[model samples]
Target: KLTAVLTYHVVAGKVMAADVRAGKVKTVQGSELTIATAGGVMVDKSKVTKTDIVADNGVIHVIDTVLMPK
Candidate 1:
């Protein structure tokens, strides 16, 4: 239940902030996440506050709101 929602926020590969563009991306949870950079980086209706947090495995992007799978 919750795991699906959590993985829905995760994109495969080490994607950076600048690398992100407006498009539909396949999330780790096997759902499509709508990414829009028109006004700013947005996943669905959630605003991306921070991005490009480098990690050993993958990067982390901080969003103002938590994402829920539909």
Candidate 2:
């Protein structure tokens, strides 16, 4: 359960802020995450506070809320 929830916040590959699109993106947990780019970037119900934090494996986007897998 913890692993599932944790992986739900992760998306495969290095997705930069410029490449983000308004659509459903598949997470590492096998659940799809809805992305909205209207006023700002949103992952699920959480707002993306930060973007494009480069990591060794992939990029990280900070969200205001915790994403749970359905």
Candidate 3:
């Protein structure tokens, strides 16, 4: 699922993609997501359009595109 793929983009240690200087995040699907700012913080080709959707176990960040592990 896209939600799971985005969730995998998150690190166990609470990291803000905005704070990333330069690095990549590995998704649960084992895909590498490049962190950078075009208009805003982007996960690979997806943009985090919204943030902080709280659930019982974790959070969800809305993205522009569904991320697939390559």
Model 3 lDDT tens row, 1-70: 7776555665554444444544576665566678777567776777788876666665667788766655
The clash count for each model shown is 0, 0, 0
* Highest-lDDT candidate: 2
lDDT of 1 by residue, 1-70 (tens): 8889888888888899879989899999998988899988988999999888899999999999988888
Point out the worst 10-residue segment of candidate 2 by lDDT: 52-61
Which of the predicted structures, 1 or 2, would earn the higher TM-score when compared with the native? 2
**TM-scores of the models, in the order given:** 0.92, 0.95, 0.64
Candidate 1 vs. true structure, TM-score: 0.92
Tell how far residue 30 is off in model 2, in angstroms.
0.4
Comparing 2 with 3 on TM-score, the higher-scoring candidate is 2
For TM-score, the strongest prediction is 2
Candidate 2, residues 9-66, lDDT tens digits: the string is 8888889999999999998899998999999999878999998988888888899988
Better of 2 and 3 by lDDT: 2
